[model samples]
Target: MDQGIVKLLPAVRGIAREAGEVILRYYTDTVTAHVKADGSPVTAADNAAEAVILPALHHLTPDIPVISEEQHAAGKSPPGDHGTYWLVDPLDGTKGFIEHTGEFTVNIGLIKDGVPVLGVMYLPVDGDTYAAAGPGTAVYGARARHDVPISCRVVPADGLVVLSSRRHGDRERLDKFLEGKLVKEHRHSSSALKFCLIARGEVDIYPRFGPTCEWDTAAGHAILLAAGGSIETPDGQSLAYGKPRYLNGEFIAYGRK
Candidate 1:
């Protein structure tokens, strides 16, 4: 494990939890979604969570710039040349939030040289967090540091458990993408929990043909990567960060190294 990351991870976990707390306030109220420039929904909760997370992340790692979803929507951006920066989705899954589903998350991921080396994801409603730092083992918890170290499991011979996005992508497209794969069941979830399930060994793979931003996958990517798994392009190459415009291409996540 990177010693620096070891020291940094705990502070980041606290920051994520604090941001989650901020989102809960909005969740309990009737949150009114405001559309962003890209036609994605936003709310007071997104702004509030980003405001709380951004400063604390800067405080924890003074040299790292935070590129947050809400901030980006407001045209606030950091230099593109930065090799180490934080990618934050202060509130992921706005539709789910509006629907009162407890599937949204607060995501903070550290990208270094185009790869996520650390991440923290918090589920506000339940206070569950799945996090990883550098090469250290990943962990899952509810309201505490961690309950257990998480690692991915191999695909079972009986078939595979797959994770699917709740309201994104076309089912037919996914069916086509999954043609010959043996799948026993599909678990539908929103936001970053799909990746957490891969890290927790609850699923074998997650394939997506839908559009997603860097913040949407970075934290989960890091946790999954650390938990003896990886994310890759359909062509089988590793997925990388720091791409043009922070956009993501179609990719699949596997619960194996």
Candidate 2:
């Protein structure tokens, strides 16, 4: 890990947690949901959380620019520079959050040269924090006494367990894929949490054919990769960051090393 990034972990974690706290404040209290032009829900929590997170990221790494979900929805995009930058989904799983499922997450990732090198994903409901700075090592939560080391499974066998979205399940395709194979399914509301489950060796795979943006997966991708898992295109190509359109194609996260 770079010394700078190592030094930055606390700041990033603090920002994520604080933003999560802010989001939780307005989660269920606000009745009406704000929708974007595309008809996706955008609550006060999303904008409020981003307001807290983006400034903190800028203060932590003044030179690196931030690309956030709220900003992107507002018609902003990352620069064409090939240097490092921050990717943030200040309130992931907005629908879940709005529904008061308590499965939303605050994500922050450091991407360099088209790949993530450091990332943090924080779940406010449980106060769980997952972080990784590089390959082969991931530390979750605070470092003093509660932090736990996490890694992915090395070899997945038959009866493999997979995590699927609770709100976005596609029964037809999932049933077709699981047929003739021993499989167990676990459902979760947040994308980042699903990735954390795979990173901690609790799930074998997560496949998504639905639409998602770069910010939605960047943090989890970094943590999963650091824990020896991989996020790749359906055809097995590695997932790349900083695309012009910001929309991600179909991808699968494999648990095996």
Query: What are the clash counts of all predictions, listed in order?
Result: 0, 0
Residue-level lDDT tens digits of model 2 in 76-161: 75556656889999988888787777888999998888888888999878888998888876767743448889998854555678
**Which portions of model 1 show Cα errors greater than 4 Å?**
144-146
Best by lDDT: 1
TM-score of candidate 1 relative to the true fold: 0.96
| lDDT (10s digit) by residue, model 1, range 1-257 | 77887788888988999998988888865779888778888888988999999889888888999888888877888865779889999999888898898889999999998999999999999999999986547999987554799999989989889888877868998889778988899888888889989999899999988878899999999999989899999899999988888999999999974
Query: Which ranges in model 2 have alpha carbons more than 4 Å from their true place?
Result: 142-145, 155-158, 185-188
The number of the candidate with the highest TM-score is 1
